[model samples]
Target: MRTVQYELMRPGELLAEKERFSVAYLPVGPLEWHGPHMPFGTDPLDAQAVARGVAQKIGGVVFPTLYCGTERARTPQELQCMGFEEEDLYVVGMDVPANPVKSCYFPEEAFGMILREYLLQIVEQGFRLVVIVNGHGASGQLATGERLAREFTHNTPATVLFTRAMQKLEEGDQRLGHANISETAMQMYISGDSVDLSQLPPREVPLKTCDWGIADALEFQGLGNAAHTVEQDPRDATAQLGRRYVENGVQRISDQVLAAYAELEPRQGTKA
Candidate 1:
């Protein structure tokens, strides 16, 4: 059990643990709709909570959460009702958008470059493994993440591990989506008061509702829907459930992270 640690290593601490197990865990989330009940940062926050618990359990460093994504747009109707001639502003994690208009959105390549730069710096600081947890749950992000992980590891001794890689080490079920039970519950646990369950948007509506269906299907032009927000029946979520989800998810990640560390240990001439 590698002493279950995280990024508390200061300058002196770093020197103290030159041979200590080192890993950096980052959480990736986007600012977007999460129904009316949950806050916009639900996805990333949920992932962060899970990552922190895992770091505590497996001796890993938890880095700050990244909220940027490809592109984000508010539906015309939501904008109208919110009384916004433009996109209303919201904060996902620590960053407040310049305008309500999705500013964090960018090309996948650009996002990858940002991630690569961040990891490269960490590797230079002597970290042996970098674990990134993407709560965005987009298949494109996951696919791209895999490629980035490979490229990152190919270029350096530092290894990149994404949340999905954990599934291979554990039999447990973990989903990658928003507003689902897992996400809603996790939000409830993370910030119960901030979650306005009373204002939850209506569910049980036809899937073909004008918002996403036949008729004037609105393609967000060239921008992707990375920051676009939507929610499930988050009002139905409970803090108890949120805690359970976080606990379970963290365990899954910790299990996989430990396995990865073990597999890479021999190459580094270290033992766990």
Candidate 2:
């Protein structure tokens, strides 16, 4: 009912709220490039908004979002998407940044460990339900959260759930993309002042899908001709569409959180 952000609440407030409903929402995303119109923090920001909405609906506490997740290694095709010729690029360790693409990535193992520790801390704080909502579509990042949730819940009283806001939408309602229609619209709704649709590239960038398995390997090997940087077109995105996305996403996520909380109610009663 009050501020759902864990960091903003007083110790007494948190303790009282924990007794009322012991659910913690953790939002995770990457700081990757989201075209010129949207800010680089779009993923986590959108995720945090969704988490906040869910927390407000279910009386849960939302944690500070984790922005370090797996990102695609830049390849020749990716270079082209940013308007750089293949010959203009040079490999710099695991990155090939000819364009300004800001993404914070943690190795798969390290991310899993970080998630595990975060969950442990939340459980230690007496929370019985943990909801992990990710905004990034990278398989490695998504998998890390889901895997950690399964492993942690197997050995603890906490019931951890790993899911993405987009995953809750119907297939027809979903249009998951990188800085494209869905994300652009959602960001516009969440932080309208920050969004500048005029900055979108002049031409529409064609969408290219990749096999996650080979996509990462090829990028690492510098052999993929796929555009891993940008996907879909955001020229038609509007704040109204974004509001629709937020409304639908919040309802779906809140419903799931409520269901999880109901299931954990019995265990919560046993805790004290």
Where is model 2 poorest over a 10-residue stretch in terms of lDDT? 209-218
Whole-model Cα lDDT per candidate?
0.57, 0.70
Which regions of candidate 1 are displaced past 4 Å?
1-9, 71-103, 164-176, 201-232, 269-272
The prediction achieving the highest lDDT against the true structure is 2
Q: What's every prediction's RMSD, in angstroms? A: 8.2, 5.7
Evaluated against the true structure, the overall lDDT of model 1 is 0.57
Among all windows of ten consecutive residues in candidate 1, which has the lowest summed lDDT? 213-222
Model 1 lDDT tens row, 1-272: 33233354476655554466678787876665554456777666776777777777767667777775443234455333322344554423112232233224556678778777777777777778888887764444676677878877767777788783112123433332345445666777888786765553456542211132111112112121332322223445577867776777787888778888887756664321
TM-score of 2: 0.79
Flag clash pairs in model 2: none
Error of 1 at 224 (Å): 22
Q: Give me the candidate number with maximum TM-score.
A: 2
